[model samples]
Target: MTGIEAINVYCGLARLPVPALFAGRGLDPARLDHLMMTERSVGLPCEDPVSNAVNAARPVVDALSPEERDSIELLVTSSESGIDYSKSIASYVHAYLGLGRNCRVMEVKQACYAATGVLQLAAGYLASGVSPGARALVIATDVSMADARAGYAEPATGHGAAALLIGPDARVLELDPGAFGLYSYETLDSARPEPDRDIADVDASLFAYLDCLSRSFADYRSRVADADWHTTFTRLALHTPFAGLVKAGHRKLTRELTGAGPDAVAADFAERVAPSLHYPSRVGNLCSGSVYLALCSLIDHLPPGAPPQRIGLFSYGSGCASEFFSGLVGEGARQALAPARIGERLAARVPIGFDEYTDLLAGNSRCLLPVADRDIDLAPYERFLTADPGRGRLLVHRGTKNYHRTYEWV
Candidate 1:
């Protein structure tokens, strides 16, 4: 109804290395009996979030031609960690990816809901026709929450990155009408200082937060009950701050909506976790990227012919805002997702020692040393970097991974 064209999801091909939780930290990856795995990972990669983003975007950029790359309208990045107080990460990505000067860029903040917001915004942009190319690239990347030994985000704490190229085309997921709601008046479930945050209690409050959303869901359902609707969704994907949160929220909402007993509801929650289904057990709460990861996991693991597969996307941001939206997994959804390629990447990663993980986390640049360009020669893509400290510039191609970031100094 919005006259919006298309919203294609082009997942960039790249991965962060898993930190040394296996070797240096005296931890065992095998112990993660209920965690999720990416297409691939490297521990050292987690140290620099910027580099992680650049790495993820490289393959996707290479996939496009110079003209297409130059036509990019915007690069919306969602991250709780802003590279600097004032300087936006969009500038860095625009330069690193070799986009034109006309590219409009901005960073989104709202915890894990930021990326989802980008998707929503892109839909609005497509509804308008001012830009030459109706395309928006949304990228989400976060290293492991600095500390690994503690918290629910642990085990989930690993470095990872994912990218989606959104545009108006007939090839991707189409935005359906009447698909969004914002849950307001809810208290912040988790909040931390801007710098040096300690999210020890972030996941601890998930139940409470889900409870808040469930009440809103109930009200919405009551309002919609009068309209006879035959079609229903196949899956419900939440901005998963933690794996257990999915069960808690699903149970609470299902019981209220279906009138099932606690036992029945509990069983339903367990049923959602299929054997082949790999949840985000390792990547922790990647803020805005959580829901996207859930979608990716379901698409990557679900069996073919899984019908009635409507996905419910839940986005919750502390301070606090929550939303519920749905997407239809059309007949061609899996084919467009390129599942085989994503699966291959996840299967090819190398594990690292926790010490090496910490070392990568402690990444930085030498003040005296000049910025050097990295020689990145990957297939179907050319990589280049330029640094201008004189203008406080950081043009980098695999520059340095310091303080858990690999941002190119452009």
Candidate 2:
């Protein structure tokens, strides 16, 4: 009886067209047809991982009754963008959200899969009944380290966060008991060995993703009775590094499990998978939070007053950890998440051309650096900040003082 009670995302107030970025980087325009992404989020210098997490979770937290808010017994913040080695982003998120001090707070790493990893653990804890009525807040937030060096991935690498409130209520998604799979190994498909730099082997990453999708589902089938990839779930969400990757992964799995011809596969994808790609297509990859974004897209796409449905989910993180799991979305799921206004906020994001995006890279790159002291020149980013809809509640990083990160509400 434990699963996601609510979910929301903070995708920044700016966006860059993928074509604009491709042209700026001198990449082949033809590749856009394959990427399946129209735009990517652009993070301002004043915004960092901590702020992204807080901004995303604030609405969800504030919507809770005081009793419900105090019941949140755990907070886990997952991110690849770490500002300080010893400190976890949870510390900042916890303080900003004003959660109970008794809550268990920690951070995790494992590339994009980190959020799902911790989410499963949290669900188990809540279901154990030792702390009856306890809830957990899981936020997967990251800033893009992508630039010209990342090549095509640079355009797909988005910046934002997804926040989920997991509890016994489970209005949004209810966990299917003991129906899951896991796969992990060591391979350097992608890594951020140093701050402000990202290196990735696109080919290795893609292969690993598709490979994990197939194997994880197989493992899941072995555990669950009468599990059929084609019929077990009505809708599916795979980690979307880009929409095309999800399409490719779906094609691979659909082919193996059903042996469907290309035409059937295409029709199945358009119905079950394409709805999940809408957010990824707009905001690009959300790292650890990517799959959740896909899930949000899927739920939001549901017609109002639709019947309850089961959803299949796949999450793959790059130092290679992955899982395939199933959850039930209740009839009120979409209405429960409506307060977040994810789509409206995303549409409100101001569009930035190639020139402004190119200028942002330098400032955004410094986000993960462990510098002793610096001041963010928000003066240059006034437009992005001035008209923010969540102005007072939106947390933003001011800079660092003696290596101490500072943040203030916008």
Best by lDDT: 2
Model 2 worst lDDT run, 10 consecutive residues:
385-394
Instruction: Give residue 81's lDDT in candidate 1 (0 to 100).
Output: 63
lDDT of 1 at 106: 77
| lDDT by candidate, in order shown | 0.53, 0.92
* 196-308: candidate 2 lDDT, tens digit per residue: 89999999999999989988888999999999998989999889999998998999989888999999999999999998999899999999999999999999998788889
Candidate 1 residue lDDT tens string, 1-410: 23112222222222333333433445666643433333223334213445556556665666677877776677877776665666566667676777778777877776666677777777677557777465777777654434553443444543445566766552334555456656655455555443434354554356556855675454444544442111354555676665656766777677656778988776665555332135354344556666766676666555777653556567777766667665555556566566325444443333434554455443321111233433222221121111111212222334334422244333
Q: Model 1 Cα displacement at 180 (Å)?
A: 1.1
Clashing pairs in 2: 112-288
Candidate 1 Cα lDDT to native: 0.53
10 residues in a row with least lDDT, candidate 1: 380-389
